[model samples]
Target: MGPLIWIIDEEWLDYEDEIRVLEQAFPSCAIKKSGYDYRGDLDKFGYLADAIISQIYVKLDAGAISKLEKCKVISVYGGGYDRVDVLSANKRGIAIAFVPGYCTDDIADYVMSCILRANKPIDSYGSALNDRIWGLPAAGKLRHRIQGSRLFIIGLGRIGRTAAAKAKALKMEVSAYDPYVNEEAMDSMGVRKYDSLEEGLGEADYVSVHARLTSETEGMIGIEQLSRMKPDALLINTARGKIVREKDLVEAVTNHIISGAIVDVVAVEPPSFDEPIFHCPGIAVTPHVSYLSVESFKELKTRTAENVVKVLRGEELKDIASV
Candidate 1:
C-alpha cells in the first residue's frame, strides 16, 4: 500500500498545489482531507498516516501524538506551530516542520502600512470627505510626521528585522528590544538595542511587536507596559495574539493610555461580535492576515508540502521546529 498523508484542515480553498507537489515527489502517496472540526476517528487516522499537514487551529497534543503509529512528521501550514505539542512529537520521534520566511516581506509591508496609517490620519480625512464634509476633520489637523519618528520593535526576528529596514528607509529612527539578539547585531542594522522593554516603550513614538509566542511572551504586554508608552504613542502587533493581553489592550486604547493600536491579531480568533476590542475605535483589528499575499500564500502551500516530502525521504528539513 502507498503511504497515507492526511491534511487536517478545511481552511484552504483547494489543495491543488499541495497535491501536485506531493505527487511529483512521492507518486504513490495517498492523501486525505478533513475539515477543521474533524470528528472522525483520530486513532484510525493517526495509525494509518505516514505524514500529516495541519493548520494553526488543529491541536496535536500529547494524547493525539500517542495515537500515531507510522506518522513521520507533522507539517504546519504557517510559521507558528504553538497548537502542536512539540515535546510530545519529539518524544515519539516525529519531526515538526513549519514554513518560515514565506511571508516576511508581506508581514513587514503590512506593519509599514499600519505605521503610516496611524501617523498620517489620511483615513480620517477620507472619512470626513465621504461624509460630505468639506475641509479636513479635526483629527486630520493633528497628523504626525513619519520621518524621524522613533520606532521600537519588541522582537528582532526575521519579520522584525525586515520591518526595521523598511522603517529606516522612511528615515524613522528604529530601536529594538530582544534579549536573545546581541547589541552588535542591532548596531549592524543601525538600530539601538534597549536593555528593558519599559525604557523602549517610554521613548518610542511607535511600537511594533514581532515576537514569537512562547511561555515567556504570553500576556507580556499588559496595562503596565501600555501605561509606560507615551500618551500619543501607537502600538502595532502583527505577531501572535496572546503575546498581548486583549482585555488590557482594549482598556489602554479605550482610556487613551496610548493614542491607538493596530492589531492583525487578538487574544482570540474571530472574537465575539461584542468583543470589547471592537468597541474601541482607537484600536484597528484585521483578521490576522498580515502573512497573506498572493505570492506568500502559494509559497506557504508549496513549501509546506515540500517539508513533508523531505521528511518522508529522509532528507534534512528546512525550518524544523527547535523542540
Candidate 2:
C-alpha cells in the first residue's frame, strides 16, 4: 500500500498544492484529508494514514497524541510548532518536520509596520487635516518620531535581528536582549547586548518583543516592564501572543503609561469583542498575519511536503524542531 499523508486541518491553498507536487516526486505517496481538527480524533486516521500535515499555530492536546497508531511523521505548515507536543511525538518515534527561515522576511516586514504605527503619532494625522496642524504635535504635547528613537528587541533570532536591521536603517538606536547570544554576535549586528530585561527596557524609547513563548515567557511583559518604558515609547509584539499578559497591557495603555502598543498575536485568537486590550485606545491589533504572504505560504507548503517526502524516503528532513 502507498503511504498516506493525512492533512489534519482544512486545505490551505498552498499546502494542498504542495501535496500534489509531493505525490509526483514520490509516486508512492497518497494524500488524505481531515474535515476538521484532529485534536481528539487521531483514531480516525488509524486505519488509513501514516503521517500528518498540521496547522502551524493550532495546539494539539495530549489526548490526540494518545490515539495515533500508524502515524510516523508530522509536517508542520509554518515556523512554529507550539501546537504539537514535541516531547510526545519524539517518544512515539514520529519525525516532526517544518520550515522556519521561510517566514523571516515577511514577518520582519510586518513588524516594521507594527513599529511604525507604535512610534508614529497616529491621532495627530487626523488632527492635522481638521485642525490645520502638521506631523509634529506643534503645541499640545511632545511629538513622537521613529528616526531618533531607541529600540530594544527582546530576542535576537532571525526575525528579531531582521527587525533590528530595519530599525537601524531608520536611524534608530537598536539594542537587543537575548541571553543565548554572546558578545561577538551582538557586536556584529552593531547592537548593544543587555543581560537583563530591566536593563534593556530601562534605556529604550521603544520595545520590540520577538521572543519565543515558553513557560518562562508567558506573562513576561507586564506592569513592571511597561512602567520602565518612556511615556512616548512603543511596544510591539509580532511573536507569541501569550508572552504578554493581556490584562497588564490593558492597564498600562488605559493609564497612558506608554505611548502605544501593537500586537499581532493575541492570547486568544479572534479575541472576544469585549477583550479589553482591543478597546485600549492607543493600541494597534493585527490578527496574527505576521507570517502571511502568498509567497511565504508557498514556500511553507513546498518545504513541508518536501520534509514529509524525505522522511518517507529515509532522507534527511529540512527543518525539524527538537523535542
Model number with the top TM-score: 1
With a 3 Å backbone cut-off (N, CA, C), the pairs that clash in candidate 2 are none
Give the per-residue lDDT digits (tens) of candidate 2, residues 140-197: 5655677877889998999989988988899988899998999799989989999989
**Model 2 misplaced regions, further than 4 Å:** 10-16, 39-41, 119-144
TM-scores across all candidates? Answer: 0.95, 0.90
- Each candidate: what lDDT? 0.89, 0.78
Task: Give the clashing pairs for model 1.
Answer: none
lDDT tens per residue, model 1, 1-323: 66799998857889999999999988888998877665465754756788999987788888888888888999999999998999999888899999889999999999899888777656567666667787533455464689989999999999999999999999999999999999999999999999999999999999999999999999999999999999999999999889999999989988989989999988876467578887788898888889999999999999999999999999987689966
When summed lDDT is taken over every stretch of 10 residues in candidate 2, the lowest stretch is 39-48
Question: Which candidate number has the best lDDT?
Answer: 1
